[model samples]
Target: MRAVVQRVLNAGVTVDGECVGKIGRGYLVLLGVGHGDTRAEADKLWGKLRGLRINEDENGKTNLALADVDGEVLVVSQFTLFADCRHGRRPSFTDAGAPDVANELYEYFLTLVRQDVEHVAHGIFGADMKVDLVNDGPFTIVLDTDSL
Candidate 1:
């Protein structure tokens, strides 16, 4: 599993001109499932993502966790994160998980997060989605469960 986590003032996902998911003062997560990803990977990444000290404290230091700041999270399925461009101009998505496998893990990840976070939002698993966010501090981090 891989995730691009961005600290956002607000974020929303729109599909077919209808807003599907939205959040405020938290993370805008572009999440991807690799071909062999499992619940273990999802668990590892979720812990790190939730504990991230990206929000500002009273001293202007990045010391607050999502819960501490009363933030929300918007998770978007993004198979494109696994794009392979090493070979040619066009990227290959063979490295991404198959639809069924990816969707299962995606739902599992969302379940795990929803259990812990006060507020959670998510995009449709296999939908064409448009995500928009106002990045707070433009603070972003990329996490790969393969590294953990």
Candidate 2:
């Protein structure tokens, strides 16, 4: 599992001209499930994400977690995070998890997130989505299960 976590002032996802999910003052999570990924990986990733302290404090220090600032969250399925581009000009997605399994883990991860977050939204899995956001401090973090 991999996730590109971006702190945003606001974020939303649209599908076919309809807004599917949206959030305010929090993280825009682009999640990818790769081959052999499991619930354990999701669990571990959530643990890290939930405790991430990137929000700022009164002293302008990035020391506040999501809960500390009453933040919302928008999650989107991003299978392309696993794209293998080391070979030729074209990127290969052979490393991404199968659709069925990937969706399952995606939902599972969402469930975990919703349990702790008051306002959590998500984009449709396997759908073409347009995401809009104003990045806060333009702070971004990339997390991979292999490195954790």
Candidate 3:
């Protein structure tokens, strides 16, 4: 599993000209599930994400976790994070998990996130989505289960 999490002042996802999900003062997370990944990896990443001290505190330090600031969350499925681009000019998505399994894990990840944050938004699974966000501090974190 991999996630590109960014602090955002606001974020939203649209599908077919209709807004699907939206959030304010939170994180815009682009998540990907790769082949062979399991629930354990998802759980581990969720734990790490919930505790990440990426938000700014009163002293202007990036020392507050999401909950500390009562932040919302916007999660988007992004299988391209597993794209294999080293072999050729065209990127290959063979390393991404199968659609069925990937969607299942995606939902599981969302459920875990919802447990901690009051406002949890998400992009439609397998939909063509347009995501918009105002990045706060331009702070971003790339998390991969392999590196954790």
Candidate 4:
């Protein structure tokens, strides 16, 4: 499992011109599932993200976690993160999980996130969607469960 976490002032996802999910003042996470990812990996990454302290404190120090600021989350599935581009021009997605398994894990991840955060928004899994966001501080973080 991997995730590209970006702090955003606001974010929204649209599918076929219809808005499906939206959030304000929180994270816009683009998550990917690898062939070997399991519930344990999902749980670990979710916990780490929830506790990550990137938001600024009253003194202007980056010391507040998402919970501390009572922020929301926008989770989006993105299997392309597992794309292998080291070889030829065309990237290979052999490391990405099958759609059936990936969708199950993606839903599980969102459920886990909702448990800790006040609000959680999500993009349609396996759909052609458009995502837009006002990146707060332009702060972004990448997390890979395999690294842990």
Candidate 5:
């Protein structure tokens, strides 16, 4: 599992001109499931994400967790994160997980997050989505289960 976490003032995802997911003062998570990924990996990744302290505190120090700031979350399935581009212009997606397995894990991850977050929104799995956001501080973090 991999995630690109971006701090945003606001974010939303649209599908077929209809808004599907949205958030405010939170993290926009672009999540990807790679081959052989499992619940354990998702668990570890969520643990790290839940504890991440990137939000600024009163003193302007980046020391607050998402819950501390009453933040929301917008999660989007993004298998493209696993694109293998080392070879040629056309990236290979062999590293990405199978669709059925990936969707199951994606839903599982969303369930885990919703348990702790007051508001959690998500994009449709396998849908073409358009995302818009105002990046807070332009802050972003990339997390991979292999490193966590």
Candidate 6:
């Protein structure tokens, strides 16, 4: 599993001109599930993200975790994170998990996140979504379960 985590002042997801999920003062997470990803991988990444101390403290130091600030989360499924572009001009998504399995894991990941943050929101699993966000501090982080 891979996730691109971005701190945002506010975020929302729209599908067919209808807003589905939204949040304020939180993280916008673009998550991808690989072919070999399992519940364990999802669990690990969720825990890591929840505890990640990227938010600033009262002294302006980046030392506060999402939990510490009572932040929300907006998770969006993005299989393109597994794209392999080393070859030709076109990128390949062979490493991405099948939709059936990927959707299941995606829901599982969301469940884990909601366990900690009640304000967790998510985009439609396989729908065409338009995401909007006001990135806070322009703080962005990429996390891959394989690296851990």
Best by lDDT: 2
| Number of residue pairs clashing in candidate 2, backbone atoms closer than 3 angstroms, sequence gap of 3 or more or interchain | 0
What are the lDDT figures for the candidates, one per model?
0.93, 0.97, 0.96, 0.96, 0.97, 0.96
Q: After superposition, how far is residue 81 of candidate 1 from its true place, in Å?
A: 0.8
**Candidate 2 C-alpha lDDT tens digits along 1-114:** 999999999999999999999999999999999999999999999999999999999999999999999999999999999999999999999999999999999999999999
| Residues 1-148, model 4: lDDT tens digits | 9999999999999999999999999999999999989999999999899999999999988999999999999999999999999999999999999999999999999999989988899999999999999999889999999885
User: On a 0 to 1 TM-score scale, where does candidate 3 land against the true structure?
Assistant: 0.99
Q: List the residue pairs that clash in candidate 5.
A: none
* Candidate 1, lDDT over the whole model: 0.93
lDDT of 1 by residue, 48-105 (tens): 8888888999999999998899889899999999999999899999999999999999
User: What stretches of model 5 exceed 4 Å from their correct place?
Assistant: none
What candidate 6 gets wrong by more than 4 Å, as runs, is none
Question: Which residue runs of candidate 2 sit more than 4 Å off their true CA positions?
Answer: none
lDDT of 5 by residue, 1-148 (tens): 9999999999999999999999999999999999999999999999999999999999999999999999999999999999999998999999999999999999999999998899999999999999999999999999999988
Off by over 4 Å in 1: none
Better of 1 and 6 by lDDT: 6
Clashing pairs in 1: none
Clashing pairs in 6: none
Worst 10 residues of 4 by lDDT: 139-148
Candidate 3 runs further than 4 Å off: none
Report the number of backbone clashes for model 6: 0
User: Is candidate 3 or 5 superior in lDDT?
Assistant: 5
Tens digits of per-residue lDDT for model 3, 1-148:
9999999999999999999999999999999999999999999999999999999888999899999999999999999999999987999999999999999999999999998999999999899999999999999989999999
